[model samples]
Target: MTAPAPASSAPVPAAARHAAPPARAHAGAPRWARPGFWAVLALAAVLYTWALGSNGHANDYYAAAILSGTRSWKAFFFGALDAGSFITVDKPPLALWVMGLSARVFGFGTWSMLLPQAAAGVAAVAAVHSAVRRSLPGTAGHAAALVAALVMTLTPITVAINRDNNPDTVLVLLLVLAGWLCLEAVRDGRTRTLVASAVMVGLAFNTKMLQAYLVVPALALVYLAAAPGTVPRRFGRLLAAGAALVASSGWWMLVVDLWPAADRPYIGGSTDNSVWDLVVGYNGLGRIFGGSGRGGGGGGFGGESGAERLFNDVMAGQISWLLPFAVLALVCGLVLATGRARPVAAPPSAEAPVGAPPPAREDSGARRDLPGARAALLLWGGWLAVHYAVFSFSSGTFHPYYTTAMAPAVAALTGLGGVLMWRAHRRARAWAWALPAGIAVTGAWAFTVLRRTPEFVPWLAWAVAAASAAAAVGLVAARIGPRVRLRIAAAALATGLAAGLAGPAAYALTPLGSPVNGTNPTAGPAGSGGFGGMRGAGGTPDGTRGGLSGGTRPEPSEGTPGRPAQGTPGQAPQDAAGAGTRPEGMRGGPGGAMSEQLIAYLKANRGGAAWLLAVGGAQSASSVILSTGLPVIAMGGFTGSDPAMTVERLQGLVSAGELRYVMPGGGRGGPGGGSGGSEVDAWVQANCAAVDPAEYGGQDSAQDGAQDSARDGARSSLYRCG
Candidate 1:
C-alpha cells in the first residue's frame, strides 16, 4: 500500500487562501433536518437530569461544600466544607460558586446543586457540535457535527460526571468553549476572539486549575500556524492572550492567597495553608511528580504508567471506545488536506504593485476547499494526544473519570474521520480502506471492553463483533459495483456506527440503572471493576451497589493515614445523604438516614457553640451539615491530610464554649499527623468525657478505650469536652 503523503508544516499565505464553499443552506434544508440538533440537545438534557434527585447530594463531599456556601457567602467564596469556614474543599471555588448560587435560589436540594453540571454538559454538547460544524463546512460538516454531538452526549464517563457535582463538569464545558472560540478567532484573526478563548481557559483554570491549561498548546499551535497574519503579528496577539490567561486564572488565587489566614478558611490540600502551595504543589507539580501530601494518596489510580494505561482493564471502558478511530482521523485528515493542495495564481490585492502576479499562491484546492478542517484536526488531535500522555503517565492521583476531558476530542475526531474516510470511499482510493479499518478496530475494542464485564450484558460483545464484521465486508463489497455502491455504503456505515457505539452506549446507560457514586464516579454494571479494581457500586468492599449504598462511603476510622474507606457487606449506610424511601421499584437511593437521634441531641445540647460538631474529615462532617444546614467542621479537609487544625486551636474552641463534641476519624480520612493529630487525640481522650451511646440512639463514639459503644460503622462516637 502507498504511504499517505506528509502534511506541510509551512503556513499558507493569508492573501492566497480562499474560503471553503458555503455549506448547504441549513435554513433551506427540510424541517426534519433542523430539529436534529435540538433532538441531540434534548437527549443530553434527559440523560443528565433524569432522576438527578435520586443522586441526593451526589459526592457528599462537594455537596456539603455547596450546602455550606449557600448559607455563608464567605464559605461560598472559599469553597468551604462548613458554613463556619474552617477549611475549604481541595480545588478552587468557581464550581462551588456556580452550584452555590443555584442552591441559594432554589433551596439547596439535590436538583439545585446538580442542575448546573447538567446544564454545563448540555452546553458542552452544543459547543462540540458548533465547533466541529464550523471547522468542517458543507453537508458532510453538518452530519459530522451531529455525530460528534451524539458521541459526546453518550460517552459513559460524560454521562456519569455530568449527573454529579464535580468541578470537572464545568471544566470540560469551558475548555470545549475555548476550542470553539479559538476556531472562531482563526476565521477572522480577531484578537478579541483569541483573547476570549484565553479567557475561557482562564475561567477553566479557576474551575480546576492547571488541568485547564492542557488545551493551551493546541489553541496556540493552531492560531499561530493557521490564523491570517504575519509571524510577528501572530506572536504579539498570543502574548496579549497569554496576559489575559494569567489575569483571568490568577485573580481568584491572588485574592485567596492574600486574605488573612485567620479570617478565611484554611486552604485545603496545602501544607502551608496557601492557595499557591495548593496550585504549585498539590494540584500542579504534585500531580506531575508524586509526593506524600499532594493529593495523590501515594499514586495508585489510572493503572500503571504506559501507552496501554488508557486501554488497560481498569480504564478502557471509560474513554477509549472511539480513541483508535480518532487517531486514524487525525493522521488522515492532516495528510489528505496537505497532499491534495496545488498552488495557483490569485487576483492581485490592493497592496500589490500595478501588474505583480498574485505572489505565488501557497495553498490550493483541498486546503482552500476545507480551510478549517486542518486547523480543527490540529486542535482536537493535539488535545487528545497531550491529555492521553499526561493521564497515562502522570504519577499523581488519577481517576478514571478524569478522561472526560478527552471525550470532546475523541467525539469530534470520530465524526471527522467517518466523514473523511467516507469521502475517500466514494473515490475508491487506497485511503478508502481506513473506513473499514476503523470499524474493525473500534468493534474489536468495544468487544474487549464489553468482555471485561462479560456478565453485565452477555451478548453485547458478540453482537458488536458480528456487526463490525458485516459492515467491514459490506463496505469492501461496495467497491465491486457502481449500481449498488451508494445504498450498500450507507447501510454499512450505519452498521459500523452501531457496532462502534454499542459498548459505551451500554455503559452510559448503566448509570441510569444505578445511582452513580459521587465520590469515585465510574459507569458500568454493579460488579464491573473500575479504578483500582473496585466494584462500580460506589467502591464497596462487601458487594453492595449504589453510590450512597450502606457500607460503601468511607467512614472515620482508627486506620492508618491515607487508607481508603471500607464498608462491610451487611451494614446499613449511615452517611448516605438524602436517605429516604424511594418509589417502589426505583433502584437508587442513599438507603439510610443520618442518625436523627444524634442530630437532635447535638442540637439540644449546643449551648451557644459555634459548631455543632467536629469530625476528622469531610465525609463525616458533610453528612451532618447536609442534614441540618449548620456548621460542622471537617478538621483535615478532604482526605484528612491537610494541616487545617492544631491542638491549640481545638483546645481554644472547647475552652471558649464554641465547641463540645469531637469525633476522631469520623470520615474516611484519618486525622492528619501533621495537624496535631496525636496531640489532639490525646487531649480529647484525657480532658473530655465519652458521651453515653444511649443518649443518641447508641451512635456515640468512643476513642482511647472510653466505652466503645458506637454503632452504625463505629463512626459516630463523640467526645464531650467542657
Candidate 2:
C-alpha cells in the first residue's frame, strides 16, 4: 500500500486535497456500518456482560445502595446508603440513579446492578471507534481503529472495573462520549455540539464529583481555535457552553441542598454534612493534594503520588504499556502540524509582472490544513496530558483502576499519532524519527516497569524491546532496498504491534478467577502460577472463592488506609465486610450466606420502636436493611465517617420511642478506624447499654492492625438504646 500524503493529515476536506486510505486498505462504505462492526460489538458484549451475574454484587457498598434505591424512591433520589435514607453516599447520585433504575426495571440482583456497567463499557468502545473513524478514515486508519479498540478493551484496568460496579465505569463512558462530542463540535464548528459536550462533562461531574473536569481545557482550547467563526463569536459561544455546564451540574446540587436535612441522609464524606463541601473538599482540592478532607481518609502522601505512580510495579502492568508511546506520538504529531505549506515563488518574468503585484501569489490550493491538525493534537494531546499530570502527582484518593479513565485517551492518541506519522513520513524521511523514538521510549519504560516486579517474564520484556527496536530501525531506513520494502514494513509493523500487545494479552486472557477486590485492581495473571487462579474450571483455593465466577472476594482490611470512610468493596450482603465468611440466605437470590439469626432478632425485637436497629455505617446496616426490606437506619452513609446524626438527635429519637436497639459495633469506615468511634459511636457508647458479644455470637475483632484496620468495627456486638 502506498503511504498517506502529509497534505491530507487532518480529518477535514481541505480546500485542496481529499485523500482516501491507501489503495490496499478496505475499500467500501464506512467500516462502522458494515457487518464487521456488528461482529465487534457482539464480541465486546460477550466480554463485558456474559454471565455477569456470576460476579454477583462486585462492590457491595454500592450494590447495597442500588438494592435500597430500588426498594425506596426516597433512597433512590437521595443516593442513600440505606433504605432509610439516614445519610447520602459521599458522591452525587447519578451513578446510583442509573444503576438503581436498571435494577428496578430488570429486578434487583447482580445482573441488574452490573449490566449497566457492561452496557456502558460497550458503548464507550463504540464511541471511541467512531472518533477513530472520523479522525483516521483510511484503510490504514481502519487497522488503527481496530487496534485502538482492542487495546482499550483488553486494558486490564478497564476489564476489571467494568466487571464490577464502581461509578468510574459511568464516569469513563461519559468522558469518552464527551471526547467524541468535542471532536464533532470542532469538525462542524457547531456551537450546539460544543454546548452538548459541556453538558456531558457536567453530567460526568454528577457521576464522580470533581474528577470530571479534566477534559474541559482540551475542549475549550480546541473549539476557540478551530471552530469556524469570528473570534468574538466563538468566544461568546464558549461562554454559553460554560453556562450550560454549570447549570446542568448545579441543578442537582441545588436540589440536594435545599431538601430539608432532616428528611435525607447526611452527606457522607464531608465534616459538615454538605454535598457542596464534599464536592469541593473530599472529592475536590483534597483529592489533588492530600488528606481525607474533614471526616475520612482519601489515602496517599503528598509527592508520593508523583509520576512514578503510573510506572510503579503495581500500576504499570495494568494500563501503562502504551503511555510512553502516546507521549512520543503527541509531541511529534504537534511538531508535524506546525510545518505549513511553503509559499511558492514565481519567476520574475521579464518586465510583465513587476508592476502587476506578482499576480497575487497565484492560488495553489495546497496550503496544509494546519488549523485542523493543531485542533486534533490539542484535543487528544491535552486530554492525555492533563489526566497524566493529575493522576501522577495528585495525592487524593486514587486507585490503580482509576487509570481506566486514561485508557481511551491513550488508545486514541496511539492510533491517530501512528496515522499522522505514516502520513508525515511520505513528506520527509527524518519525520520517521518518531517511529524509533516511540519504540525506544516505550521499550525502556516497559523494561523499568517489568524489573520492578519480581516474577515478571524477563524474556518477554527482552523480546518486546528487541523486536520493537528492530522495527523502528527498519521503518526509519525504509529506502535501503525497494524490492523487499513491503514485506519488511509489514514485519516491522506486526512486530511493533506484538511488542505493545504481548504483556496485556497474557494478562487479560489469564484466568484470574477470583473476584477483583480493592479500590485499584489491575488485570493480569493472579499469583505466581500465571493462570493458577483460573476462575471457574474448578473451585478456587478459597473454598468460598467466587473466582472468575465473580464469587465473593475479601473486603478492605479493617480500616485499610485509603479505604473510604464508607462503602466497602466486594462484601456479600449477608457476609460481614472483611469477615471472609458468607451468611446463609444473605441476599437470597445469590447462593451466599446470610445473617439469619440477626435478621430474626431485629424483626422480633421491633415493637413500639421506630427503627428495628440503628447501625453505625452503611456497611453494617445496608445488608440487614436490604435483606429484610425494612426501615433500619444507617447513621452515616457508606463510611460511618460523616456525623449524620448528633447525640441530642439520637437521645430525642429514643425519648420519642423512635429508636431502640443500636447495633454500634459493626463497621462503616471513618476516623474511628471502627473502634476509634465517630461522634455517633461515642454517643452510643456513653449513653446506651452494650449487649454481650456471646449473646449473638459476635466477636469484637481487634482494632485497626497495621495490615487491616478497615474492619476494626467488624463485630456482632449489639447495643440497646431505649
Estimate the lDDT of model 2.
Answer: 0.64
Q: Runs in model 2 with CA error above 4 Å?
A: 1-40, 292-303, 342-373, 454-459, 510-512, 525-595, 608-610, 668-687, 693-716
Alpha-carbon lDDT of model 1: 0.76
For each predicted model, how many residue pairs clash, with residues at least 3 apart or on different chains? 5, 25
TM-score, structure 1 vs. true: 0.86
Tell me the deviation in Å of residue 138 in model 2.
3.4
Task: Report the C-alpha lDDT of model 1 over 1-722, residue by residue, as the tens digit.
Answer: 45546889998767336234334437344455458889999989998987665565667678778878877888998889888999998899899999889878866666677888999999999989888877766677888888999999999889989988889999999999999888877877789999999999999999998999999999999888888778899899999999999999999999988998888998988889998998988889888777675756545556777789888876787888899989988887777666655676776777666776775574433545566787788889999999998998888888778899999999999887678778877774676688988899889889888887776678889999999999999998888787978899899999999888888888787665444566667776644434322244222334334332333433222211111123321111223432221121121222123455667778889889989988777766776776677798878777676778788889889999989888765545445422227677677778898887677665334452232243322654478897
* lDDT, candidate 2, 580-658, per-residue tens: 2223212312112225555566677778875668776666565565456566666655555566667778888889988
Worst 10 residues of 1 by lDDT: 555-564
Q: Would you list the C-alpha lDDT of every candidate in the order shown? A: 0.76, 0.64
- Could you give the C-alpha RMSD of every candidate to the true structure, in order shown? 8.4, 8.3
Clashing pairs in 1: 550-573, 556-665, 700-717, 701-717, 701-718
